[model samples]
Target: MRRNPLGRTGIEVSEFCLGTMTFGSQTPEDEAHAQMDRALEAGINFLDCAEMYPVNPVRAETVGLSEEIVGTWVARAGRRDAWVVATKHSGEGMRHVRGGAPITPDTIPVAVEGSLRRLKIDCIDLYQFHWPNRGSYHFRKNWRYDPSGQDRVETLAHMEDTLGALAREVERGTIRAFGLSNETAWGTAQWLRVAEAAGGPRAASIQNEYSLLARMADTDLAELCVNEDVGFLPFSPLAAGLLTGKYQGGAIPPGSRRSHVENLGGRITPRVFGAVAACHEVAGRFGLDPVQMALAWAARRPFVASAIFGATRLAQLEHALGAAEVVLSDELLAALDEVHRAHPMPY
Candidate 1:
């Protein structure tokens, strides 16, 4: 439960952040509350959520239910001061929210109000743009990602306008920090430049899919985070449960993420299971639980400020919590590197 600085925001959060994407869907309210309690007791202070969550089967009716559930917990727990809450504003392509509109300056205020009302909080500790208006390469979209058609002028203008609106929110005491999600190194650099020029809040963190299997952030993104003082918050650090060894040998447990979303957001591929097997072997050689080893590896990355992970059950949360104490040795780290070299980009 080591604490790391949240960019230059002067807020320190636990290295392990509790993710609430399954708050109302895969997990019920009472169970969600119990998970939160367990995470807090284990010294986790950061809670990550989103405006459109409970995402196993994201629906229009349950768009904001996750925030409402967290709000109820905050209301009853009466210890909001102890938690560093983070949530996101969905970007374009989500038809259920804002009529599937892109995140523009005009939409910032409305989105902030909706999130605040649902979270029952006057201010969000870290407010992130869920995805860029210009799409991202995350969720296994890198193979088809094309940024060549992007208009730089229009993109810069949009960044400035949105940053201005976020500045207004800062002045209004509605948000303390700003961040990005599913963004690239170039995108993050543009955001930093725009924020500097506009005198708005600098990007504090970047939440992207990062794990042993997904090492796209290991180069340019890692450099950007280190040099720019931006915290790297890795989402799906377990590779969407692939690293937990539960989906190996073609076994899809009942009610698991695979059962709901067959491919686990396009992460499933013919080669991924083989890679998972290699990682599992490394974990066994090191005498570590595969789940804890995967999480610990992500948390131990040099640029990572926090590794976000979610659980539908309390036992899963407890198992993940053990990662806080499982430190990978140099030998094991080298073995993992060898495995990565052999099976890089499994999906």
Candidate 2:
């Protein structure tokens, strides 16, 4: 329930953010609403969603269903202002939206308008680019992630032009802050530079995959966040449910994320289960729920402003909420760090 500053935007958000990517796919509308209600009641005031959500098996037909569900909840409750809503603009490679077009100056207004209309909100508190148009190393693409062919001049020009478009949205009161997702330190710096030069919305946060199983953000990106004042929002703090120990012992429970996406988005690996077991052992030593332990560990990072987590059921959400108060002891943190050192980059 602790609130932290969202970058330098003067906006305070809860340490934990409820992710709604499963709303219309793995979860139905009524259940999604119930989960939201439970999260809010548990002091989670930040909600994160994206235009390309409900994404276990992303399809054109259900592209915007997640946003619509959130909008319906807001309309029915008449409390649009109760939560700090953050959503994304699909960057590139999403065929369902704009025919797989990369985000550009011409597409900003169109995407923003679509999100606003679907969410039934006048303005998005935090508008984020889903990913860099140039591509990123996230989602298990690091093995072949090569930036050698990127054109610097063209990238900078594109950033400046995009910032200009975002500036207009800010002036029109359509967005309060801007952010990046699945981006790198260099990419984030360019966005910040462009925003400063154009007097556009400054980059307020960066959402990236961070978890016990994924530590890519613990290096350069961690330093960038600490120095630049851009809040670090770690998505999948539980490693797409890998760190929760449910997928341990090769048991893929019915209706689990693994059952839907067999590899959990390529997170499944020979070393992953062993790492999960190591984490579970540490939690057992401290008599802690592994789910809460994993979440708390991510939230307790030096540069993290909020840790985004998702749940398909209300019971799972209730378990994750306990992480808000489960402060890990220094000894426990060291143990977790040891495990990370042993199984670094398992996926």
Candidate 3:
């Protein structure tokens, strides 16, 4: 695994970040620990989690279970320094956490302390807002997304307020860097601008859904990240297994997330299968595993700092790690780009 700089925070992490969303949900603690051990063995020092993780249903009782699981591992292993631990403060719409409250200046301290206690760590390597309180266009909300209702003054005030709070956490030595998720380029710029002006943590990275099927980041978002030195941490780089062809022929594999979830993780696009077929065909022409190719394509993006991948099973995690060494050539990338052009905005 290759180490990449995590924005300008001076933190270097493996390009492959192990996502632990299923740590205490679909996966047992022992299995999750084993996966973490294997990840460390494979040179993956970065791990991504959220306070609202282990997310099959994200119930109130299970809200911090994922962090607790990782905390237990951290305590037992006593190797907290060996990993770049990243976690998030849940934003609006999460009723289980702080009554679905939006991220505000006042919520930062409570949230940070909770995460630190649950993770058994004095400081977090990267702390992120799960989503903006003002709302975001991500997660298939783009079709109905409208910014006309937003109050510019109120939004900028929120940005500055939150930045001040985040900087306080940094000063308190509770967080090393601040990041965003499910944010837009314009929103990102404002955060950067606010930090630059008021003296706070600049947005170090963004965690969003980017994959072969979702190429919204390829244009403006890509440019902003590359120029601003903000890292792109893409989750669901495989299109939630669509690019792997496991959902091909309209067949859901046994024990897959699709078999249980009604909406299959909120990816309900009519052109999805067509897009997957196109990608699989390209991978076949290149004689590459569709899974590895999908991951490698996402990880090799110019603005990507790390690609976050989750798994319910050890075998699945191992398969994803195999992409670490599978480098895509220029021709392969160009062919993939053609595939993207052919089936753009699948979701």
Candidate 4:
């Protein structure tokens, strides 16, 4: 439950952030409340949700339900200030959010207003672009990612416009800071460069899939975070439960992410099993729970400010929060580095 600075915003957030994408889909409202209560009791003061969430199978009918659930908790408990609430503006496609249109300057106010109305909150702590309108290589698209045809001038215009709108929100007291998700290193740098040149708020964080199985952030993203003072909010520190070793040996427990996503969003290939086994062995050597070790490993990264983890049940959340105090030793960290060298880029 250590608190870390969120970029240079002067805001401190819990090292572990509670992700609420499951709030209105896989979990009920009462259960979501219980998870939130448990997290706060365990010293997790950061919560992340989105305008389009409950997304195991994101649909139009259930869109925004996650925020509504969080809104209910905020309204009933009157603890909006107790947590650092972060949410996103979905990029495009999916047809359910914003009619499949990309996030634009006009859409910023509209999206923020919807989130405000749904969450019953006046301002957001960290508002992020779910992805770049130009598209991203994240979510297993790296193999086929191609940005050669993208127009840099148009992209810069978009960044300037987006930052202008966000600066307006800052003036209006609707958003405190901005972040990026599923973005490339160059894309993020342009946003930061423009924000600084325009005297607007700099992009404070980048949310991407970073775990034992997916180490794409270790190369360029990590360097950017170190140089820019931008925080890394890893979305799946457990590799969607693969690092927990629960899905080892081709076993899929009922109600697990693997049960629904089968391959854990293209993360379940043959190469991943060895990495999972190695991590499990590492945890056993240290007498630590695999789940806690996985989370703590991600949280203790030099560039990571917070590790975002989701739980469908309260017990699952409790297991994740236990990682808050599980500090890794130099010996264990070296072992992890060796494992990474052996099984880099499983996805």
C-alpha TM-score for every candidate = 0.99, 0.99, 0.98, 0.98
Candidates in order have lDDT scores of: 0.94, 0.92, 0.90, 0.91
Q: Give per-residue lDDT, candidate 1, residue 239.
A: 92
Give the winner by TM-score: 2 or 4.
Answer: 2
Q: Indicate the TM-score of model 3.
A: 0.98
What would the per-residue lDDT of candidate 4 be over residues 1-347, giving only the tens digit for each residue? 68899999999988999999889888999999999999999999999999889887788999999999999999999988998999999877858998988988999999999999999999999999999999899999999999998999999999998899899999999999999999999998998999989767899999999987788999899999989999999998888888878888999999887777788788889888888998888889989999999899888899999999999999898778789889799999998888899988888
Could you tell which candidate, 1 or 2, scores higher by lDDT? 1
Residue 248 lDDT, candidate 1, scale 0-100:
89
lDDT of 3 by residue, 85-200 (tens): 99999988999999998999999999999999999999999999999888999878898999899999999999999999998999989999998999999999999998999889
lDDT of 2 by residue, 161-264 (tens): 88889999999999999999999999999888877876678899999999998988888999999999999999999998999888987889999999989889
**Candidate order, TM-score descending:** 1, 2, 4, 3
Q: Number of clashes in model 1? A: 0
Query: Residue 253's C-alpha lDDT in candidate 4?
Result: 96
Give the Cα-based TM-score of candidate 2 against the true structure: 0.99
| Model 1, residue 338: C-alpha shift (Å) | 0.4
Instruction: Return the candidate ranking by lDDT, descending.
Output: 1, 2, 4, 3
User: Which residue segments of model 4 deviate by more than 4 Å?
Assistant: none
In candidate 1 the C-alpha lDDT for residue 307 amounts to 97
lDDT of 3: 0.90
